[model samples]
Target: MFDYQIKDNCLSNKNILITGAGDGIGRQAALTYAKLGATVILLGKTVKKLEAVYDEIMALGAPEPAIIPLDLKGATKQNYVDMAATIAEQVGQLDGALLNASMLGELNPFTQIHEQIWQDVMQVNVTSQFLLAQALIPTMLNAKNASLVFTSSGVGNKGRAFWGAYSISKFATEGMMQVIADEYDSSTLRCNAINPGATETKMRASAYPAEDKSKLASPEDIMPLYVYLMSDDSIGETGKTLKAQ
Candidate 1:
């Protein structure tokens, strides 16, 4: 796992947004951030799951959380713009945003990759991120310091034979993070990417069903990096991809 000490109330008075917060690493991150005193905004495709996370955060006696039920696959630029506007109105400012929602599509040979699957992966992993980040930049700038974190994969920079569109989209994700980080080089807002290496999650299971689950790291094991990127500790770090293992 990433070497960082977890601090109490490290994110106090901060408003953090986490997409795909209903499950996997996203879910663990929401719970973890809430426990650390952040006012988390849980955004996911399932309303029930978001509500469940909301209740969990409230149970922790942390700040009350907000929920945004959104499916990235069908989301548009205007939708992201409106969502950012609403966040600005409701939270006043965004301290951090974890763009963790992504589609794996299917792992297939390049020549056998399906067009629709490719488009779907690109839409969820690339286009939605572009739109959301573009819309959220202004609101994020409201804070004294803000972090925009994108999720990348091991295949993100390397071209894997069977990774297909998923790998390609991750490459785009890395590019987008770099572009934003460069544009905001001297600004308060920082952008970065994280590759959660081989964690035990639903996505990992789907990709490798026969693998030994017990040998893999849990979502909680990889949260130190997530918290580090969101907290004030990573103020000057940007445009780099770090791994959590």
Candidate 2:
């Protein structure tokens, strides 16, 4: 679908929420969507980073963006519910979401993974996403067309050594996306997952410290797929895993 160019203003009047919007792929997606004409709700743990993004958006003369400073690792179900309620009351219906926040727990043998680290990874990458989606479904339903994009990993599809809880969490993410897609098959809301293979981001550097970063695609480079998946151009595309490289 990304082979064709997305026209300017494709996202005009759209309201999208992006988790991890403070940096990396999430940050780029927020900027890209705003440039294309969407009101982006930035959700992330760091206020300073989110503020930077907000300032950048403002400087770009894009649509005014909103900030929701949240830590997925500690966010409760009620917190997600309240977030949805807040969006409904303050921002109206949500048109899309990029569920991009994730944790890279210590990569080790499954048996060697620390219990707390495993739990933290699952909480941030899987449980919080599920809860967020559950809470936001109503807001999405209000839109004529809604899109939900989950960030997946290559290790999630095919198990790799030493990926530990991160891999397992991504697998769960893929399953959650599929479940939501199936459940919403009759509705206008669509759900899909994207695997951003070997990107040049902090996470990638942490995972592969010795590798050359110059060869990897920057966060901005893979945004066409992100833009397409969130736009109306991807209508009827759901329950599929896309690679952004």
Candidate 3:
């Protein structure tokens, strides 16, 4: 895990948005950020799951959370633009956004990869992120200091034999992060990518069903890096692909 001693109310008065906030690492991150005094915007496909997370955050007596149920697979650039506008109108100014939602298509050999599966994976993991980032950038820039964190994978940098589109999308994600980071090199809004190495999540379970999940890290275990990137502690860091292990 990335080592950082998180101070109480580190994210006080901050308005952060987290995609895929209903489950796994996203869910844990929402709770964690809320506990640290951030007003989290929970965006996910499942309304029930988002509500559950909202309840959890409220139970923690943290800032009141807002939920936005969006299916990234079918969401358009216009949808993202409108959503960002809504966020700006309601939240006033955005401080951070975690582009953590992704899809894992069928794992197969290079020659056997399905076109639809490839398209679906790319749509959710790459295109949606691209659109969302484009829409959110202006709002994020409104803050005195902001962070835009993209989720990458272990196969993001290295091409894996059976990872297929998932790997490719992550590679694109890293590239996208680098591009945005470089563009805003001297700006208050910093961009970066995080590769959560082999954590125990549903995506991990589906990818390696036979593996021993007990040996893997939990979502909570890798949260230090997530928190660090969003916090003021990482003010100057940008364009790097960090690993949370």
Task: Name the runs in model 2 displaced over 4 angstroms.
Answer: 1-4
Q: Write the per-residue lDDT of candidate 1 for residues 70-112, one digit (tens) a residue.
A: 9999988889999999999988999999999989999999999
lDDT of 1 at 228: 98
- TM-score, cand. 1 vs. native: 0.99
Q: CA lDDT of each candidate?
A: 0.95, 0.93, 0.96
Task: Show model 3 residue runs off by greater than 4 Å.
Answer: none
lDDT of 3 by residue, 1-245 (tens): 78889889999999999999999999999999999999999999999999999999999999999999999999988899999999999987999999999999999998899999999999999999999999999999999999999999989999999899999999999999999999999999999999999999999999999999999999999999999999999999999999997
Error of 1 at 101 (Å): 0.7
Q: Write the per-residue lDDT of candidate 2 for residues 1-245, one digit (tens) a residue.
A: 23547689899999999999999989999999999999999999999999999999999999999999999988899999999999999978999999998899898988999999999999999999999999999999999999999999999898899998999899999999999999999899999999988888889889999999989889988888999988999999999999986
Sort every candidate by lDDT, greatest first: 3, 1, 2
Q: What is candidate 3's TM-score against the reference?
A: 0.99
> Which RMSD values do the candidates have, in order?
0.6, 1.1, 0.6
Estimate the TM-score of every prediction: 0.99, 0.98, 0.99
